[model samples]
Each structure stands twice: as C-alpha cells, then as structure tokens.
Target chain A: MRWLRYLGYALGGILLAGCVAFLVAAWIYRDIPAGVLEAKYTTPASRFLNVDGVRIHYRDEGSGPPLVLIHANFASLLSWDDAVESLKNTHRVLRFDMTGHGLTGPDPSGDYSLERTVELTGRFVDALQLEHFSIGGTSLGGTVAMHYTATHPERVDRLILLSPGSLEGRSMQRAGRAVPKAADILKYIAPRALAEFMLTSRFGDPSRVTDKLIDQWYEMWMREGQRAAILARLRSYSSADIVKVTAAIRVPTLILWGEENPQAPVEQAAELRQMLGSAPGVTIITYPGVGHMAAEEAGPAIAKDIQTWLAAPTVRQKESVPP
Target chain B: MIAARPQLLSLLLLMAQAAAAQTQPAMDAKGWNLDTAPQSKTATPAEPPSTLNMRVYKDFDGRQQRIGDTSYAVDVSAVMTRCNDGSLIITALVIGGQLTPLDNHCPTTSK
Candidate 1:
C-alpha cells in the first residue's frame, strides 16, 4: 500500500512536469495565422532579361508613355504598388527590384554599382523596345535613375527624385557608410532578425511588423550569393558618383519630399533644389505628415504631378531626341 | 521523518523563488501605467499606457525578445491599468520604432 502511494505521487509529479513543459513550449511557439504566412510568400511579378540572366521582378501595367519606377534600399517592386495602381490606366509603369533585392538574381559578378543598375535599365528598356521613357526612383533608386538620365540623356525624358541620397560632401561626414562591413556582422548574428529590424525601423509605425513578414525576408536573405552581392554593392557604391551625376542631368527634374521623413530630411531637398539651378522648371513638392513613403502617403497628388510633368514641352522634346 | 521532509520542502521552495527572481529582470516600477481595457479580437492597434511607452516585447519563458518585420501585427490584451491623469489615456503599443493602427489589443473598457 505504501509503495502504491509513492507510485501515485511520482506519477502526479511527472504529469505536472509534462504540463508545465507543454505550456512553456506552447507559449514560445504560438500558432501563426496561415493567411498571413502565405501572403508573405507570394511570388512577386517577374520578367526575365535574356542578356543578363537576371530575373527582374516588376509591375508593368498601363498604356501611355513608359514610366519606370525604382524603389529604395531593402525594398522590392511592391514598394511602388500604390503608384502602379494609380498610373496603370494612363502610364505604362515599370518597377524592377534591383539585383540582390526582392526576387531578383544576385549577380554573380558582384556588381551592384550605380553603373550596373543603369546598364541593366538600358538593357531592359532595349529589350522591351521602349524608344524613350520617363524615369524616377526613391533613395538609392533615385540616385541610379539620376545617373542613367545624365549618362544616357537621349533615352531619358524627365526625372522624378524622391528624397534622393546623393550629397557626397555630407554623406562622407556620416560615420557608418560601411553598409557592407556592417552586413558581415549582421550575418554572424541572426540575419532574419536584423533584416526585420532594419526594415521595420524604416516604417513610421511599429505595430505593422509581424512574424510572417520577418520569415519572408529571411527566406529571401537565404538565397545563395544574395548577401554577398548586397554587401559587395554596399562596399563599392560611392556617393560621389551620384552627386557628380546630378549636375549632368539636363532633363526636367521633379523633387519629391516627405515632411516628416527622418531618412531624407527636408533640408536635403532644399540643398538639391539650390544645386540643380532649374528653380522654375524643377518643382519640389512636399507631403506633410508623411514619412519616407510620400508617394504612398499622397499617391493621387504625386500621380497628377507626374502626369503633368511628363506632358511638359521640354520633357516631350527630350523624349523625341534620338538616343 | 515528517519534520525532515517539511524542512527539505521549505528549502526547495526558497531555492525555486530565488531562481525565479534571478531570471526575471527588475521591472521598471515607475513606468507602470494603465493600458486600455480589454477589447474584442478585431484588428486594432495594441492600446498603450498614457504614462509610459510600452515597447512591444515578447516575454517568452521570461526572456524579452524584440519583435521585428513590418508585415503583420501581434494581438495583446491591455487587461492591466495604472493610474495616470484623471482620464485613462490610451496609446497604441509598438514593438519596433514604427507604429501602425492594425495591432489587435483588448481595450481597457472591455472589463
């Protein structure tokens, strides 16, 4: 009877231990909603460039003149989803994720320089048989677009820059331009967590971040050779190149700014305006109460300006000019 | 034998309490403020306390993990409230620096 009592107590204790362990595990690995996780894994709109062996993820819907959209760092074609919807009816909009970004191929050549992006744009334009087009981009994309326009002035019609980061003088002053070097450290730590932190921090709202979102970025980061390409691009890229390209841009340029954007403050826009020297022709529009994503925050207004600016006589003249 | 068992049990209980205390980080007592009352499971922002900014942290096995990724939101209940001003001021809780109104948190009024 005493042995039976001891056995009962041991069994109860074991059951309790099992229950506790189960509870702790359940808390740690909470169920993720299927819809949310699946949504993150949906493949982006894609196109293959025969010349470069690059699978360019883009949204190319619309009718009128070609308008190419370029997104910022750590962003894919979806960043311009709002613009694509607004302009698809009137403009043949195009947006491609830069190499090492989104679903695009990580160029084995380790070439993510502004020149390579410009070259890829040229190839893509040629492949699509686009005679001339209006081009614009945000942040890093803006810099690439500017360089492309300046280098191949004949092919580009007009320019739209959204808080571009191209001031070499000031960029040099900032200590941590070592994006590539930092990437190595991030790689050693949890890559998914770091990417999530980097991306989530950029947004004005923290509540928007979700676990499934981090998982998708993690999958993308896991793509072989992608991290290397991203790091290489970071190490090789120079602000001086972008700054130098700005002066050579002869097309009608439109500068877009977000009032509360911490990344590219309004002061940078003011400086770009001063340096461009096309005060009347070069228009600077600000979206108050918006963050880095002004086009998204004020889509209709931006679309209207783009449509009008594209129709301007000078921009038209540049488009008609032979490449 | 009974006395010896009781003494052993007391010692074990004390050790367990010490372990628990050691593992748990000291809560910032001053920052404790009233969050909103419990709300339905509808998609809404996580209600925050007016007195203190409650950063979204995942307390897993007593470890605080910073949540990241701006793709979806987590659901939390604002069951507890701390006295602040005359009226309960409710701000949405944020995990990362970004804040969106999509988080689902139980409102303080639900109680």
Candidate 2:
C-alpha cells in the first residue's frame, strides 16, 4: 500500500512538471509570426468551383483575357482579391483556394504536394478549357507553377512567381532537412486554439488579425480531417524530394520577391533564377518593404508589372485558338 | 492645371462609371465593353479562343502603366503603377479573364 501511494505521487509530479513546461513553451512560442487569413476584398464575384472533388473557392470576375493567379500556403483566393479587382476591368483573373487552404475543403487524401497542386492547376485549366494561358503564383504555388511550366510548356504561355517557396531545389532540401516529424501532432492537439496561435504568428502586424478572418481560419482548421491534412503536408515538406520536378522547368519565368520577405529571402529567388537558367527568358524582380504577403501589400504594383511583362508581345506564339 | 487635367478627367470618368455601374446592379459596364462572345458551360477540350485584349493605363510620366485604377478585365496580363505611391503592380489577371474587381466597390461593413 505504501509503495502504491508513492507511485501515484510520482506520476502526479511528472504530470505537473509536463504541464508547466508546456504552458511556458507555449508562451515563448507565441512570439513567432502567424499569417493573416480573411476574405479582405470587396469583390462579390468570389465563389467556389467544384474541381477534382474539391470545392475550390475562387474569385472570378473582370473582363478581358484570362490570367490565372495562384497563392502561397496559408492563403486563400482572397489573397489575390485586390489585384484581381484592380485588373478585372481589362483582364480576366482566376484566383482559387488551393486544395488545403481557404474555403477549399481539406484534401481527404492529404496530398498537398507541389506536384499534386500542379496537376490540380492543369485540371483547373482543362475544366475551364483554357488551351493556353498565362499563369503566376506566389510562394508554394510559385514553385508548383514553375514545375508545371517545365513539364507542360505547351500549356503555359507565360509564368510569374512572387516570392516562390524555394527558388532552388537545395532550399527545399534544406527546409526538408529540419522538418519535425512529430511537430505536426502538436497541430492537432487542441487544434482550433493552437491554429489560432500558429496562424496569428505568421503576420508581422498582429493588428491585421480580425475577428471574421480568425473565425474563418478556425472553421477551416476544424474542417474534416484538416489537422491530418496539415500533418501530411508537413511530412511532404520534410521529405526534401523536390529536385527532379523543379530541375526540369523550361518556361519563361519571372521571379518576384520582397526585399524583406523572411520566409523566402532574396537569396532563394536568386537561386530559383539560377536553377531555371536554361529557360528561354527568366526575369527576377524584387521590391522593397514587402514581406511574404508581397502580392497583398503591393498588389497594385505587382499587377501592373505582370501586365507589362505579359504584353511585351515577345514570347513564342502558339497557334491561335478558334474565335 | 493642364498637366493635372487628364488625371482629373480620368478620375471623374472612373467615378462616373463606378456610380453608374452602382445604379444598375444587374448590368456591369466594364464587361459590356467586352466583345459579345458566346460562353458555354461545358468545358472546351480544344484550344481556348483568343479573347485576349490588352489595355495599358500609363503613368502620369507616361512611362509605365498607372496603378490602383488599372483593370485586369481586358488584357491577357498587365502591369500597373500605383499613382499615389508609384509602385510597380505585376498582374496575371488578363490571361484568362480571371480578374474580379467587385471587392473594390463594396462597403467596409462586413456582410
């Protein structure tokens, strides 16, 4: 009886210590920047598209030619809302929530890799029946677009990347090197609350965090098996196996970066330019005072540059589609 | 004032268009200017039609495209320069007519 009493006290002490450590670590971890998620644009055309069994919510409006825009991780189609509306009067813009983020429900299979996203983009284009189109993406999406262009140059007329995930395959390899295997499990423990903490830290300015946006993000986090999907994505990121696909991109690529983008600094963009050196025409543009959210922070400026770059009217012309 | 004349005129035109468009909720003036092309719901397997139309709103210096007011509704792609801060705006909105400017006109009040 005495021994059992002592064992119980020992277990209680261990539990108490673990709780204290977790609370303290949580407080310290709170310092990391979380991303701002929301439908910030005033555009009413934002809707969802059911493509490949995923209800991809997108912002589709405007008039002229077609331009498909892809957003980075932890972002939705709303990230491109400002740029889309600004250019919609003269250009038709397509911006959608990728498989895992935004209103687009989580992928039940948890296949959020760049290759999968590239396939999804192709399906999106096919679904729209766009034979040839100009495409641009930011962060993770940029890497996927670059890969897609390399593999299916026939489909992509022009490509633009904004602070793409990794300009060089080595960066991804390096990122994969440090991925924590069990860290993702923490993503599921009290997920809704933890996600709030994690996402809020992605932003430099916490004031950008809004109630509506937080609610939306929380809802998405709690969606069917989202925690598992996030874990799967983390596992994919840690695999560090993005070389063969990225090494083969051959399209005209434009790499844009924010001078202050911390996640993917200017060096990464330079590395991307170096890797795709064999491409016909690859241009790298950098802006000052911009961060990971360069498109949103400098949406107006980024949009204008893209318009000019696409209009240079110098790329190899393909057979015109039937009018 | 003459140098400012074009900008003032442009602003007024934009404001008037915005106001008129606001009046007729069902009818959109911007898309109206686009070619009356037929749109089908079924996805086309063939090459997409060249509905590409490019428009450039040059900066006040007449060097680069103007920002803020530039439309992605027409061009296959566009570059805009913000008139106020003079920043470069790169956009891929024109390629497949994916631009949506609806949010710019909405109220700040959440729906």
Please report the candidate that would top DockQ against the real structure.
2
True contacts kept of each: 0.00, 0.01
Candidate 1 i-RMS: 25.1
State each model's CA lDDT, in order: 0.54, 0.55
Put down candidate 2 lDDT per residue, A229-302, tens digits, no spaces: 65566556521334455556666666676665667765565345434534545544555556677766667767
* TM-score (C-alpha, index-matched) for candidate 1: 0.58
| Window of ten residues with lowest summed lDDT in model 1 chain A | A314-323
DockQ of 2: 0.02
Q: Name the docking class for model 1.
A: incorrect
lDDT of 2 at B101: 22
TM-score to native of every candidate shown: 0.58, 0.60
lDDT of model 1 at residue A264? 73
